[model samples]
Target: MEVIAAVAAGAIASACQNAVLSSWLVSICPQRDYAKELGERLSRNAHIYTPGSDNFAAATTRWSAAHAPEAKLVVIPSIENDVAETVKYANELGMPYLAVNGGHGAIKTVGKMKNGIQIWMHQLNGVELSEDETQAKIGGGAKTKAVTDALWAAGKQTVTGLCECTSILGPGLGGGHGVLQGRYGLVSDQFVSMNIVLADGSLRTIDESSDLWWAMKGAGHNFGIVTSVTSKIYDIIHRDWAYESFIFTGDKVEALYENINSHLPNGGSLPVDIMHYSFFFNNPEVDPNNPLIMFFIIQEGNMIVDPTYTKPFHDLNPIAVDGEGGVFTDLATWMGNANTSPPCKKAGLVNYRFPIDVESYNIPAQRQVYDLFASATKETPALNGSFFLFEGYSTQGVKAIPSESTAYPFRGDNLLISPVINYAAGADAEIDAKAVELGENLRRILHEGSGREEMHTYVNYAYGEETKQNMYGYEQWRQDKLLELKNKYDPERKFSFYAPIV
Candidate 1:
């Protein structure tokens, strides 16, 4: 047992907080000496940032201010070895540490890492393609735009999220959904291998051959800090895409879902090349009482209008239509820009995965959810800009993969519904509480409508309130297997900050 100094006694309120007492464990512990040693062990390209420093502020800036966790120090490693050495040093000092890649995570657990060290991966952003062009090695800190730009330049592409600022690996570790997921699969499905620095400061490569690879596929954040990821890539089959956007009033919610159900019966029959998504929100400019629905349809080919797939949407008589056909890269750029814009910034986002069976579209329940969203926005003006996003990505390719092959459980046909609650900074506590309640209520409604007792949630979009069964799986055997792996790989629970299973 180690004695904590009087100055650090006040910080120890929980087990995690106690982990940070490493700085005060020994009377002779030299803080500057430890930082110096870590610096010497890292490569010349590595950099360190302290609190109040310009680089530190930049490194800690997150998509949502609510998820920014304070750190005693921040280190950006240039290579995998530097990460391993930093982990080893932290372990030696008994200092708690958190690994941050894209800094877009919104779970409350992120804000709980008080007085801990932050292992920033920004300096490790690198992307390289193999000579055969079948695979690309992406650094852990590489964002969606960087990966897409690199692959686009090489006439190749991979599965990545819509937000370009989000890390390629951060979402991939849980389950990456993107425009191309309908044709290919989630980003994790395309993973070939990863270079990870384990909790014990060991550098190891996790591939399909490794027993731990299965766990790394879905619940990877709990295992280790990945330094790089190698995933399968394909040449761009069609550079241009037929993109269409439609806006509808709240009265058309039922018709909108009916059309959506008609297009995606059993959630599996949709054309793999087509991706459909809808956004429901209250825009005062559109209507004060009713929420507006913005539906987007994207097809891989360059047809000005995909007659077979997109004509039905045209029949709905959308309020507005834009962009008959455009380059796929242009579409990606547009999405990235929209997500980072001021209206979308500093928002609290949560997601729920609802499995839609054949002809199981519950219009009543969905309408209620939409109504709840409208009421919430109306009652709280601060949340008027918030919206609910329904991502109906084609899951034929996802279902093609076996459940046992990887740890991703939600591989079947499903609709990922996310409630993005936006509030002004320093908003009243009542507004924040209402936003959380609205998001959870919407999730519950969708879960019950899906006819499943246990709700399934995407790990990346979870708000840290979901049970282990919801995030991992409801089956006992699956839970046992995941727990077994958890014990084997991270018994000490070092990486237990984000959606931890232990």
Candidate 2:
């Protein structure tokens, strides 16, 4: 290693809020003519940014401040080849590097990457429709809002994450869940081809023909950096959308969950046109002693949710009922995941999510978790902002794909549950440890209730404590395939910052 120059320190002084600049990790990397040296290898349009320098904030800003990486440099790739050049430059100097798109990944493993260079991909953003209109070529850095707006303008749509601020490939590569998944399958299922920069710094366009394509769909973070992707697109069939929300107090937990089970007996029987999202959040004003349960039943192609779904919940006598109707674009706003929504805000909050994929909600487990959550939040007022999420999306499209076809192994699971513990950043070590413990305990109740020996979790929302079998599948073949691919593609594990297979 070499000594860092005063110029880097000067930049850090200018941007005190940038985590990469504020951390002691800056001492680990040697200073060099990073801008001039790397710039020469990249295209003329490519630009390099250091802390407090030219759009550095845009490249460095993150949704959650928890377990974030410390970058010594931020390189913006104007084109696909620029990514390869940057990767090579980082490799030659023996520096760690990470790809930043939406900047929303907050897993604890990412914090392991120190004195690294962030290959900021925002400059590679755009979308182009093929002549046949059957597919769309999306830039790897493009956000969900961009793709949704672009496709909706062309009277088309595709499977994407629920949040507008998230990058298409950021979550897609993880087999991300979306409301339209019931119709088109998971985000990865829509992939046709992709331009990825492998660990060896080689850029190649791969598709179903490539042996690595199977791993790229799910667990892609471990293999390489995707620069661009061609994905299957669908015509906009239902322009209009409607949703009905039911809010209840703690007393109705059993009744509400039991009702849901009666409808989705096996967790995989949800209708393709419907999606349900529910959560428990603290609202002392509404229920001082407990969190309020908010349930959303969204329906496609209609201005009002059908009574078939809403009627049953209405019969339960929810404390409050609200409904909204609008076009497909309005769905995110209604669901509080729009670009401007609070959850989408880049607040300096430390968020830890303990996620699990279960066959169905256990009524007893739900009650226990709720009580535990209420008590924990009450004990620590700072954590009162936490929310327990239960995502119920139609599984027809997910299950329609062969279980062994892709790296995503939880297709059979019907529900996505997680306890998102949010608290102020810069908390003491004891506070952080307490948050982790509470999150784990909350998830444990549900896992025990499911009665599955192997806990299943969504890799995208992993808490970093889960085992390989928990995030991936438990089967020997799934583990063997992922391990084999990891060995072949990333021998040195350069891409191991986020949920490494090893």
Candidate 3:
């Protein structure tokens, strides 16, 4: 059976089997020896680690450490049934459990699981191409790099998240976005079927045949743990990819964004082959007084980005210019999201993102946020590591699908803007509170500029404070339907860690 996502990032390959299953067993339940008892229930390949064990720290380590989940025991499941067994064991003990994959989900809500069990899904990274070669059964614990490399070796490709380190399932469950989305749609759109362990610890393979399928595409975290998924795979179409990167000073903020609005609107007029992304970061060496703008124009099937797309930004007098030509795989490395990039590292920093989706960039809003980010980071030296991101992907393919066809809403919005607040771990209480203030303040500027009362946010990048309507959708039907399904499928709310409906 295949499932969607590589939930647990790659695991300790050589240590899949522990020296002694009972050596590191620690009591999870106060009365009974849960680890010693549960370890006997697992398969030979499965292992259990407690607080003092070396693997326990690795299992608990996350991309963002702020407000992370507190687990009494970590279970590394080697097979699909192992996941079921762990969930069942945790349920029988009446302990909160979270299935952690890539460990990149930074939402504060996950921290609510205290004295819980973490089902670390690192051993499920198996991939099998169908005999027809049109589909691949991906392991539930597979990361973007593993799945993409596996499928690419088979001369096939599928829509996946842009980052190489994140689990395809982590982002895929939240309406996965990627460069290929302009052509194939979001990663969730490619789901053919999935083997999910439901809240009751029953393993079930579901697809369009299930009434719960609609919500699974977008709000999957609230349903159950997916152990494996069969996803739609396509023959590699365009291996050739190219990008042009530019670094601009804060002085060019208005002109830079204005150029994007004219060059790359969210409508069908924007070519599907083109996508844009930019970041506002503090690189004091480049501009000591303010943040630097690093903008990128990535194109498919091109050795050089079309001069038509390059000329408008080139005219802005950037501080520096760079370009690269590579295959689809190199895109991750060039964008600094490869498996070895800093984003993949667990550097003990608390990260927060306040994300808002808008149809276009609001020029004055951009300028105002820039100033706010510069001043706040300058005042608090700890937050200098923070960055604000603006993603503008072409929406031709995304918009081609009917808005109501899937659970993912905000199909019309083009820009996914988020203010990422990063501060050193163990920072005092004041810094933590200030980081929240900056993130929310930055998002509010863009939301107010969008000129709409209803604010929409991408669930994947949300800061855990957004309303159900904000992350899901504003329409009455969308909200009503999601809540209705949440009640039916997960009335106990076992899977309500990342993004809960209620």
Candidate 4:
């Protein structure tokens, strides 16, 4: 019976490739019929886009140009029921499918979606505030800026990542890190409830009370498709934030690490209202020979030059300080105009989340990473735009939450790092290979230097090179529990494309 089933599955796949069989399938199990049925059953708002259509192309465009999955059809579901129907129809056809929101995901698993249907959730974007204004319900496809702008208009704020282009729920699912994380915790922590479409085409509302809620907060991308998320919001307390940018030459790289260690002593605690990000890049305008260190310091209050916070950065004596010792602006304005906006065009990108213990920050490893970056950028000029992001956010609030409360296990203190390389489309294969090699080397150096063999990577920043054990958590018990949940919610592992747990 197993042999017969394998042959049957292979035959179906082969038939799906030829036009004659495709036409036959359409005539027998027509997609238009399904569309009509879906429209009638779940409001006539769902929009279907077939191949060779403009909507299809727009829906397929991902933020990273490297991986573009081809689809036979794309459906823009207007509501949760529409999503459920789409999933049911695709399952009936035995067609592989994926759900796309902001299209910012860069993992290689996205490329595995060949000749499938793309359930584009862009039209479901709706941001509404609750009656008491203490909570906000955001549609699954809503972008970071959309949510931030809506909440800002109502004098409210929440924890969200730095980039405004990615989906709000995309980052939150993998334990999102942001400037506000110092005070409130990860965006996943702020989640109150979520509406998810399960693998069996069943719609379910999950809250903290549900047994699956803990898994959904971190490993949700593997379990189901989220249609909407209700997150906790706070009244605007500190509206304006102080921003400071500092640039240092390569010679000052050692000093930079020393100062960071001094300020972030022990790496587990920090001032709740302050956060900083560091970048190492080869900037010809600054110094062509070596990579420059750029620091972006942000303080939650309105004060421009608070001696307590600003003095440490000033003592470093940077080569240049931009923006009048940091501009005082709201979170939304800062994100929109920030220089860290990711390029919309396609490029090769790699990310790894490295944990920084008190002893992890050393001069030799730091210098070696910087020198490696400079060499790679020189070899491929297109990679000059590439840089490493050091996301060392305060973990005070993150650690405050119980370890077993959610599946996001990296709770103590760590710097989320990503080495991104950008080159024109259809660039030389050697250039791309070198770019990837450089990123992998940096990741190895950081991981090994941390004095730990076991590595834990944040799921959102993972490059698909990590195993399920590494991405989920280093603890064996956690892995066992996640596997049990994966079996319970997705027995057949239908939602296995996006960072599969099985």
In Å, residue 2's CA in model 4 sits off its true spot by 32
Give every collision pair in model 1: none
lDDT per residue, candidate 4, 1-502, as tens digits? 9999999878776665442245556554323444454456554678878778787787787766766677877888888888888778777667777999878777767778877778888887889999999999999998877788789888888888877667788889888887777778899999999999999999999998888899987888888899999999988777656766788888887878777777754366567777767888776776868788888766776546355655676788898885332222254344333324445333344322232222337678888888888887887786787777776777777878987788887776456767766666667778778767777888788777777776767778767677787778778888988989888988887787777777
Q: Give the local distance difference test score of model 1.
A: 0.78
Model 1's TM-score against the true structure = 0.90
Supply the global lDDT for candidate 4. Answer: 0.75
Please state the error at residue 80 of candidate 2 in Å: 0.8
Q: For model 4, what is the alpha-carbon lDDT of residue 238? A: 72
Q: Is candidate 1 or candidate 2 better by TM-score?
A: 2
Task: For candidate 1, write residues 204-228 as lDDT tens digits.
Answer: 9889999889988888898999999
Residues 236-314 of candidate 3: C-alpha lDDT, one tens digit per residue: 8888999999999999999999999997786767787899999999988877888999999999999899999999998
lDDT (Cα, tens digit) per residue for candidate 2, span 205-322: 9999999999998899999999999999999998999999999989999999998888645356788989888999998887888899999999999999989888888998999999
lDDT for residue 427 in candidate 2, whole number 0-100: 86
Span of ten consecutive residues with least summed lDDT in model 4: 350-359
CA shift at 423, candidate 3, in angstroms?
Answer: 0.7
Given candidate 4, what's the lDDT at residue 456?
68
